[model samples]
Target: MGMPSHLGLDDFPDDVADEFPSDVKLALFRRARAGAALRLYRRRGWNDHAVRFQYDRAAAELAIALDRWEHRETNPTLF
Candidate 1:
């Protein structure tokens, strides 16, 4: 199998699938943020500072789930 294509967070509302439920989209967003952060940390050679930065940012994004929650709550019918 080939290495997967690079996926951007913007690739989808969450999962690139056309019909994800709001809840599933939010969950996927969190997972993707964390996954991306970890990858960035590794690319930085996992230096303590880089790891901490990536981990913290990812945690904050995942914890609050900023974009998904805000959009879903504020524009419940938009998407």
Candidate 2:
């Protein structure tokens, strides 16, 4: 479903989430520092507006994942 050279930040593999342990997944759920955010996009070879968008989206995903884990832990739901 993707090309080798097109592996951008948003282009992270779908299976990546499935591979990590829940604890490791929770680690990616933290808020990344600004420098880390920039470094992440740069490492992914992003620049310009695309870089900003990818950084914002990645942060949002992390926030959402953290919230999901929080809720799951409190409610003890099957996830």
Best candidate, lDDT-wise? 2
lDDT tens digits, residue span 1-79, model 1: 1111223345334334445445545555656766776777678776556556655665554545445655665687844
Candidate 2's residue-wise lDDT over 43-76, tens digit each?
8887747556665766666666556655665799
- In candidate 1, residue 46 scores what lDDT? 67
Task: Give the alpha-carbon lDDT of every model.
Answer: 0.52, 0.54
Q: Assess the local accuracy of residue 4 in candidate 1 as a C-alpha lDDT between 0 and 100.
A: 17
Residue 54's lDDT within candidate 1 is: 55
- Candidate 1 regions exceeding 4 Å error are 1-16, 47-79
Q: Give each model's clash number.
A: 0, 0
Instruction: Tell me the deviation in Å of residue 56 in model 1.
Output: 14
For each candidate in turn, the TM-score is: 0.38, 0.44
Scored by lDDT, model 1 comes in at 0.52
